[model samples]
Target: MAETLRIALAQINPHVGDIRGNAERIRRARAEAARLGADLLVTPEFSIGGYPPEDLVLKPSFNADAAAAIEALAAETADGGPGVVLGGPWVAEGKRHNGLFVLDGGKIIARRAKHELPNYGVFDEKRVFEPGPAPGPVAFRGFRLGLMICEDWWFPTVSETLAESGAEVLISINGSPFEVGKAQLRIDLAVPRVVETGLGFVFLGQVCGQDELVFEGASFVLNPDRSLAVQMPLFEEAITLTEWTRRDGRLVCTPQKLAPIPSAEEQVYRAMMLGLRDYVNKNRFPGVVLGLSGGIDSAISAAVAADALGPDRVRAVMMPSPYTSRESLEDAAACAELLGIRYETIGIGPAMEAFGAMLAPAFGNRAPDITEENIQSRARGLTLMALSNKFGDMVLTTGNKSEMSVGYATLYGDMCGGYSVLKDIYKTLVFRLCRWRNAHVPAGSLGPAGPVMPERVITKPPSAELKPDQTDQDTLPPYEVLDAILEGLVEGERGVEALVAEGHDRATVLRVWRMLDRAEYKRRQAPPGVKIGPRAFGRDRRYPITNGYTNLIA
Candidate 1:
């Protein structure tokens, strides 16, 4: 039996539906692993077709292409280098499955399908993939590897069965998405399995943005004694070779240098940067253009854009209306200068006037209220859209979760954009992220190292600037109160009476709940944004547009 083995954990990013391209990425990683004298290369789940290909895997042509690509990669193993264990969609025994294949010596040596198909929140694997039977360890060169797909490692049955069946090591290939506090949760879940099975664990994951989802690749390894053997950095692609040896008749991994974990704020900021960067680059957008209002939402959004795509690719426009404050104009200019992004001022005064004159004939006796305010917002939206159309830059909307939750934004108005960076961030967290960005430029940031916004921009009361003397508090509750209530309503999914019991005003809680329900239509029309939290809108949290069941208790 071999006394020592070197396994390379490849943390890579794969584009969905790009079979040939993803196969090339795997080949590159395998080449690097061979150079490092590794015996085996383990990649993330669905590395051949990317994670959560949605309905794309259902097509027979795509599956055939993926199968062919996997076979081609397997043939490359004949070069007497490292073998590969990779994930892809497979159809066998008249059923479709999320399969993990072992490629060795120019052919597929073994195949294992995922037993657990995640169905909750952001995953619908059960709908597309049929669960395979409980898996056993796959025999490699003098080693038995307990292979688990992404969701299979979450439960105890698979690991327990593998250990009982004489598996020497546990390896889980994952395409898990990122959410706040998820890294620690991964460790928390992993340690228990190690304790139960008493085997070293290897977790390899992908790092990329797939539409509304962002996968932070913080792949890691746990020793048989439940100690961390290797820690890969988050939000970046890396390949680390872990050496294993038989100690006391069991496999044990040698300790490697651990990468420092970023602060929570930094993690979220990096996730935003990576998410925006991958979305723009992957979707082939030339660049991004967003309204750089002096408000915190737009300011932070612009900062993220500049950091993500570099200053030259990001464009900031100030579309000031009559209600826009002079302070806002100056602050926007200062922020644009700080970030070194392209800035231009296109006044929406003409558009507003034209719309008013055109609608004046139809409304003779009615006085102006929110209707006029909405027109101003729509005018600004129209201005931004025109710029996007002319320059082919994608519009980056700047609405936060608090505003989006209660319908504070207008649908074809302030919400006009191809994507949003702050859609999942609450108003309270928006202020915190701005302050954090001012203090530190994240590691791979392309923007300035210093502060990205003026101090007053963070301190000032937020406003849409649709009317004179308007603040967000004019229509909604204070952000402190509103965000707290929203966390209970949206994240916690608590009832109105439960919030009232927690010392929130009964009337205020009821009002927030009603508004949240009424705004479903608007949210359904909003642009896709980076998902930072567990219950992000769109894919994570799905609610019926027309619902009669209200969780209102007396």
Candidate 2:
């Protein structure tokens, strides 16, 4: 008969570069696991030094501090608590490597390095850490347990090697970031490994927002038969204990409570909220303020800011210029009232006139064109920045992906902000997210209930309101068509002709492709925002601003 083994999974949020602080967190979790009578505790990959430390791993001091923190945790385990399987940076054989530290009996019994270093997409692990050889199972408490870091379990080789080395169960830790529909992909990818090895699999993940990445801790356990035994919640830190018992010469994990995963809309909304909240809080911003233009983009951005940092912390400024309509003013006011945030009506007409007068001398009788329109936008930006400076709040920009892709935004004007809430969100998704928020206020939302967004905002034609009777369609295609074309180009990286062959107009595709190519410089200067898609502008899609590549011309 095999004795029952209790394992505690710690889904914790680790701050990057906070070695001692992360060690403190591990200590607290270890104490809780000991109180729960668990035999072992597992943490996510890069738990101590945080995930994707990037170039920080190059510093000798950072690595030294990380090693010291590991030693501290190992010494603390001397008091007879649960054994810890933690992850951090390790230096071995004159090369820095991402490693898993197996600590028991006041010492690191075994050290396993990450066998696979993912280099595609947002990961650049190959540049920083050296990959270790294929790791075999580590013997622990009368069981041969295989410990696999993130990217290791994604392939069949690691699990096969472990099973061949007499491993009974697989424990995989991850610092997996949240993208749209990423949760399902994790399960889909892990299930095949379980089927191939005929071994129970336990997935432990870290939960928190780091820069543009959000680590959703949807941890789970799958038995050898491919049945889900335990599930941890997403977008939260948790410690779940699962009991494994031997039945009929096979180790079986007992079923535990499962948390309901949020809908696609809810997941994206929460990811934005979490990403914004952490960015503001971690960077020590007093709060956030944005221009409330009563359009869907600004309205939803205001709502997200209110929900992220309570309404009191959010501030809205309505900067109405000469071209600003009465409906926009009414809807902007209504939106502010619904969210219960500080709202101010600052007419940008005065600033616009001042700028017009100042630039009149250089105009040399030239007729008013985009220069005048951009002045209105710059006026609003200047006002928002002034308010941000006075009130000590960060400015939140509210441009959607559709506008961003086609170079429809004013660079130094509307793009002036500390952060962007809807940077990666498409215009179509913006409408959907706004409707979802109105219908269902997310859990832990700080704004008032029942349709925080005014209905008129969504139904109205989207506009910058920089000129009289102007709408986005005056210069761009319908959002439905525009978003689809942009997605095919941006996400799929399809050629202009490919998009045209997909039933889109060749002229429209060529025009959009030209705009997208020309907007690289603007995007390069734009603020960082939450990334919900795989091919977000910054980090993920790195196109040179000076490049002359053009799919349309080709």
Using Cα atoms with residue i matched to residue i, what is each candidate's TM-score against the true structure? 0.99, 0.97
lDDT by residue for model 2 (68-184), tens: 899888877778879999999999989999999988888888899999999998899999999998899987778778899999999998989998888888999898889988887
Predict model 1's lDDT versus the native.
Answer: 0.93
- How many residue pairs clash in all the candidates, one count each? 0, 0
Residue 474 displacement (Å), model 1: 0.7
Summing lDDT over every window of 10 consecutive residues in candidate 1, give the lowest-scoring window: 545-554
The per-prediction CA RMSD against the true structure, in angstroms, equals 0.9, 1.5
Kindly list the per-residue Cα lDDT of model 1 for residues 424-505, writing each as its tens digit. 9999999999999999999889999999999999999888888899998989999999999999999999898889999999
What is the C-alpha RMSD, rounded to one decimal, of candidate 2?
A: 1.5
Q: Candidate 2: which stretches are off by over 4 Å?
A: 247-250
